[model samples]
Target: MHAFKRAVAPVLTFALALAIEPALAGSSETGSGGADRLVGGNGPDQIEALGGNDVVRSLAGEDRVNAGTGNDTVDGGADADSIDGGDGDDRLQGGPGNDRIVEERFGDDRIWGGEGDDLIKANRGNDQIWGGPGNDTIYGGPGKNVVDCGDGDDVLYYQRAGTARRSTGCERKVREDSTIQGRVCGQGGTDDADALRGTSSGDVCRAGGGNDDIEGAGGSDRMFGEDGNDRVFGRFGNDVMYGGTGDDELQGGRGADRIFGGEGADHLVGGYGRDRLVGGPGDDRLEPGWGEHGEIVDCGPGKDLAVIGPGDRTRGCEGVRRGG
Candidate 1:
């Protein structure tokens, strides 16, 4: 009876320990309505910080965290994690790893997608989001939001115009218009990099300073990459693109397109249909557009390289490589 009592005592104590601290046994955690500071272990954790201004940290492993209500701060440290900051002004951080974060409720929240390729959504209120390092995809849902795509090629999606203000280093900007009708013009200033896309109706898009990305999505469009290293693409319809300064890449796509690489070492490629490519100044490389017929290639000044296609009229270019 004494031996049985000793064995049962250890069993009861272990069970009591697990009951007292369920998280230690890898169980989900739910916080009280008061302010609580919860930290998870190096394994996958599900933490629901319900109510009050809580601080939650899921250190390592892929974790799912919900910061419910009040002003909260949550950090999903390492690995791919999913975090949602529900209500109140909150600061959510996805540290390292390709994480998904959603601040889908009220208050002006601040979110950081640290390192890795992250997907972040800021819904409602004027929120600020940072896509730190790596290629990240961010969505600006309602309200005036500021998205900073830090380093790497990043894509930002926003519904409606003037809803999102993008910082430099953002490679793409996609306007999610519910209706299929295209947009008008997209313009950017000198301080930051800009990704400008045109509409179905003839539109004018201009970008200034920083590394800018411009695409003429439809209709006859005019695009200007004013400064810095730029990537300008005329995706559809008859488009005109100008790469103004710095090392630039310009492609004329679909319909009768015209592209000019202005200043610095530039690469100009023609797209389908009859197109014209002009390399203005610096050592430039000019290539013929796909299925190009009767296309014009002018390498204006500097030591230029050209790929001559059949039925291409080329001038101001040296060391021509003929296409087979």
Candidate 2:
């Protein structure tokens, strides 16, 4: 009976030690060569799970995690964190801070930047990124990626080779000569001359610096030429074109349209349908031709003149000149 009691006592003590082991090791850790699980306590910690299918939870405070060489899962729980999902198909969540996540090659990844202005880069494999809030910047590389910038003014950069299926919420910068087949309604470009063309659906396209040529091809679209000397074409549907600054040219094609020349000497041409042209604040020229119907011209707060076409109608326009 005494020998039986001695064996039972040792078993009970071992179970107790195993229960307390996680609490003791919760502060910081480096994983072994096998699959491991590491959890951070309620303080700032640095964890490196090196070579296994590891699970890391950085509970609170600013933490840095490197999920090194296997299929892993990491949660950056509050405060600003930097997470690197190094070699396998991984899942990463930036709970509520401005986090930076980098996904390396091989295996598909799923990443979420919960709140704050986050930066996420998906280097390879088919990946998915969700920028929950704030103005985030996301880059999709190589594989087919789906990115949803949930709210705020965000920016997305995608490669030309792969398919980047993007939802409506962010400004997109497509590499030169690449086409976005889906419906896009955001600002385009940085300083490069971007040839932004829209899909058949109605789109709102905005251009940045550098001379840009934007075409609103099929649907009823709105084009805003923000800066530089821009040429905007509203190809098929009823469109609204705004030439913000610089010597700009606005073309309203097909259906009933409205064109505004914000600043600088702009040339506005209303093509087809009943159109309205407003020359805001510059020495501007307006051409409203009565093809099947008439057009309205409002030369607003500027030394503006209307080059009237045959059978064109002009109202509140100061200077009028006949166009041959």
Query: Highest TM-score: which candidate?
Result: 1
lDDT tens readout by residue for model 1, 29-110: 7899888877777777889999998878777777779899999888887776879899999888888877778886788987
| Model 1 / residue 87 / CA error / Å | 0.6
Ten-residue region with minimum lDDT total, candidate 1: 13-22
* Residue pairs in clash, model 1: 270-289
RMSD of every prediction: 17.3, 21.2
Expressed as tens digits, the lDDT of each residue in 155-259 for candidate 2 is 676774444444446666554233423224454655666667777999889877766767786799989888888777775688999988888878676579899
Alpha-carbon deviation at 139 in model 1, angstroms: 0.4
Model 1, runs deviating above 4 Å:
1-27, 163-166, 178-324
Q: Which stretches of candidate 2 lie over 4 Å from their true place?
A: 1-26, 161-164, 176-324
Worst 10 residues of 2 by lDDT: 12-21
Q: What is the TM-score of each candidate against the true structure?
A: 0.48, 0.47
Error of 1 at 267 (Å): 27
